[model samples]
Target chain A: MLKQYSFEKTAVQTFPDNVSLAMRTENLQVFYGANHAMHDADLGFPKNQITALIGASGSGKSTYLRSLNRMNDNIATVTGKIWYHGVDINEPNVNIYEIRRHIGMVFQRPNPFAKSIRENIVYALKANGIKGKAELEERVETSLKGAALWDEVKDSLDKSALALSGGQQQRLCIARSIAMEPDVLLLDEPCSALDPISTVKVEETLLELQKKYSIIIVTHNMQQAARVSSQCAFFHLGHVMEYTPTATMFSNPQIPVTQDYISGSFG
Target chain B: MEQTNFQLKKQDAQSHEWDARLHRATRATRKDWIGRGISYLCIGVIILVVASMLWFITSKGIATFTQNHVSLWKFLSGTNWAPDQGNIGALPMIVGSFAVTFAAAIVATPFAVGTAIFMTEISPNKGRKVLQPVIELLVGIPSVVYGFIGLAVVVPFMRHLVGGSGFGIISATFVLFVMVLPTITTMTVDSLRAVPRHYKEASLALGATRWQTVSRVILRSATPGILTAVIFGMARAFGEALAVQMVIGNAAIMPKNLISPASTLTSQLTTGIGDTIDGTLPNNALWSLALILLLMSLFFNALVRFIAKRGQLKNGR
Candidate 1:
């Protein structure tokens, strides 16, 4: 565990400084029992820019994302130091719920609660103790509009969220995440399960969200990485091989591994 | 000439091959029908057993309910239940069953739910393994043993304190509380555990406290399952015979106070086990009274089923 922690710590040190570093990790190592998932990984996510983490399956990219909000706490025996606004998130005093409120996550699968569409949007607000019917109604409308789903679901706000189409459910999840007005949004392969048109719509939503929230999206689609992200980081076997502007990373080719991955030689 | 000879032989061989293939298909079809027949036979057997049990209860107990004018209403609303006297009131017994079960539920629900939460969500890995086997063993202990313990220990203790006939609603209820606790506790835990992990994570991510998440998200989602568990416990409490009968003082009169000796429906049946009714009229009425009890139990069961059915539909939606 100690050795793996240092491995991630060294990896995080390799990134260059950017103007708006929303979240910074210094030597983050994650372990489940004896297996080391993420080696010394260091990276910085800039504000208002869509940063995409691209890697093959089992490359530790998702592990790094979950560690940001301490979602890994439930897994038992994970070691890492994640820094958000200069506070070490691993500190005993650091509340995980508060961290997650600021850094919301959208899962790969659309997991709408067994609740009405309006209630789904209002769940987070109610959890935060936001009441008053008028305020709740306004926030629900705004969040749905922000997610680009209001026009589609406005007439049936009272209908069950589970009754929505797959694409709509994923978008509803997005609305739920954004309703909290989080500082950073973490999306783990959000469009991997959707059809092509739905994928395009979700990508567009992510691009629009980049103006307000720092977005870290993990995608297997290189074209998507090229199209949506402002910056891209390529991870290989728990190591961050390259981090650069998406244009440069895709066209110019900084590292050999990144080039190999793009050319489809080996993941 | 060559074509004529070869074609004729080929046609003959082809007809034989087709005949063999058709024979094999018929055998396979017969096997499938036999398999389906066996499945249906098993189902039929189960349905038969259930129907026969209901039939037997109605046939035997129906006469007891239709015997006398006093027996019919008196069994449910009468102030006294005594076969020795011409009067056979069932109100005291009904009250006895309800009071004891209500108290038992009040005593056990919180403890059961609390234990369930600790076992499923809050307990450490090591503790979780210990919890299941312990609870399962608690459930396996026989009801007769429970009766003996209540008689030897609880009745004497109640006598010293609450006074009265020593064996009364207080002792019977205390024993029922212990008896019914495992049912609610186990089911509550199972239901809470059945809720998806996403719900918990969603609540946690929103900065809510652990207690808040459990109360708002976990418990609310698991309400139907927990309610079903409580309903099962209620059924068990009402039907419990030996343990409650042993502890409750066999007084046929309705108690004016909690300390007074009282009887339950089961107790009345046991106390009046085998005196031939004055005639078939009294016997039939007695059977009807028994049927009424059955109806009451069935009513509560249907209520639970209704709640459960609605919960299922909502979840499906």
Candidate 2:
């Protein structure tokens, strides 16, 4: 099975000099006890843009995305400089609780809290010391509308979120995240558990959100990456194999591994 | 034509033989029937035993009210409890039981819930491994031993501190607190552990601190279980006999204060049952007191079941 394919190990590509980045990583590495789960990787997310991380399972795309928000602190030993607003969030003294407020996330499965839909949206707002009833109600509507779920759920805002279908629950998760008005929204296969119709709806919501928030998504569906993202990064063996425009990456991949992976030779 | 008729006859005979064998095999075997019969008999025996116990207790408990012509309302509301002079009022004992149990619950709930939270959430892995078994070991200690310790240490200490005879509601409450702490803590830990990890993760992702997540989400989700734990502890305190009797000073009178001597239902039954003759009014009155204690226990169990059922309904399970 060893073909005469030359695999190049080059530095990950960066955005152009003039493009301002919303968040980026510098030499990010993750370790689970002794096993080096993710190698040192550097990547940039441009402001107000959609970037999709595409990789096979265990290729560390999800790991890389999770590390950006410091979600891996309790589980793994992550060492690297996560640069946002001229501060390294990887420092031990940094308050991860405060940092997470600015960088929201949605997990793969739809994990809406076992609370009412409106309470789910207002939970973080209340925790952040916003108590005005008028302000909470206004923000709840805007967030749900932003996620494109206001029409279906506006009538039942007080109903338990678990009563919603899987797709609605996923959209509600997106709504819950955006309710905090974060600068960066990280989604890890947010549509993997959804049907095609729900997938398309969530993709549209992400596209609409890109006007106000920089979105970084890790998706298994290659067509979803080509459909929605402006920039795409192909990860292989815990490293970014190639970073390019979504159209070019789909149509004419420069790396042999990327071409083989996209063409379904080996995923 | 002759060969085809013979073959058909042979096939029909063979099929009939096979059907006969199948019918015989499908019928219940002697062993199976015997086992089923034994199972039904065992169930019947259990029902009979429970019914007999209930009938006996009910018959004996109602004799004082019906045969002895004692006024049920006065027996419940009257303050005095002298059995010899025809005064069988149980108000003091009922109030004493409730007061001691309530005080014990108030004293124990916070500590037990805190210990449960520490064991399940905040403590390190090794510490939890060590602490959980140690707490479970506390439950294995005998109630009499706990009572003896309370009598020797807690009662004397309270007498010195509060300036009254040490046998009272406070001393009994302190003993019951120690007795129920392990039970409530164990149950609370189990319920807290039952909460899905995703709930905590979602809260943490929203920038909430661990404490906030535990209090708002985890505890809220586990409210039924925590309530069940508290009720179980309260039930145990309510029914406890030896330890409470030892520390409570067993004086059948209306408790004046935390330090004044009092008597619970169990304490009165234990202390008075020995002196009265069988089938007498005094004995029957004690039996009625026992029936009340039984009813209280049943009520607590029903409340626990109701809370659990409501929790299930809310969860839509």
Specify the highest-lDDT model's number. 2
lDDT of 1 by residue, B55-160 (tens): 8668766555543444455556878555556566667778888888788888889888988888887884643688778877878888889989999999888888
Q: Any runs in candidate 1 off by more than 4 Å, and if so which?
A: A1-18, B1-13, B24-45, B65-71, B124-127, B274-286
Q: Which digits, one per residue and each the tens of the lDDT, describe model 2 over residues B1-317? A: 99999999999999999999877844468678888999999999999999998888888999989989999998999899988888999999999999988888888989998988888778747437888888889989999999999999999999999888898999999999999999898999999999988888888888888898989999999999999999999999999999999999999999989898999999999998789999888899999999998889889999999999999877652
True contacts kept of each: 0.52, 0.60
**Candidate 2, CAPRI quality class derived from DockQ:** medium
lDDT tens digits, residues A73-172, model 2? 7788898899998899889999988888999999999998888999999998998899999999999999999999999999999999999988899999
C-alpha DockQ for predicted model 1? 0.57
Measured over all alpha carbons after superposition, the RMSD of each candidate to the real structure, in angstroms, is 3.7, 2.3
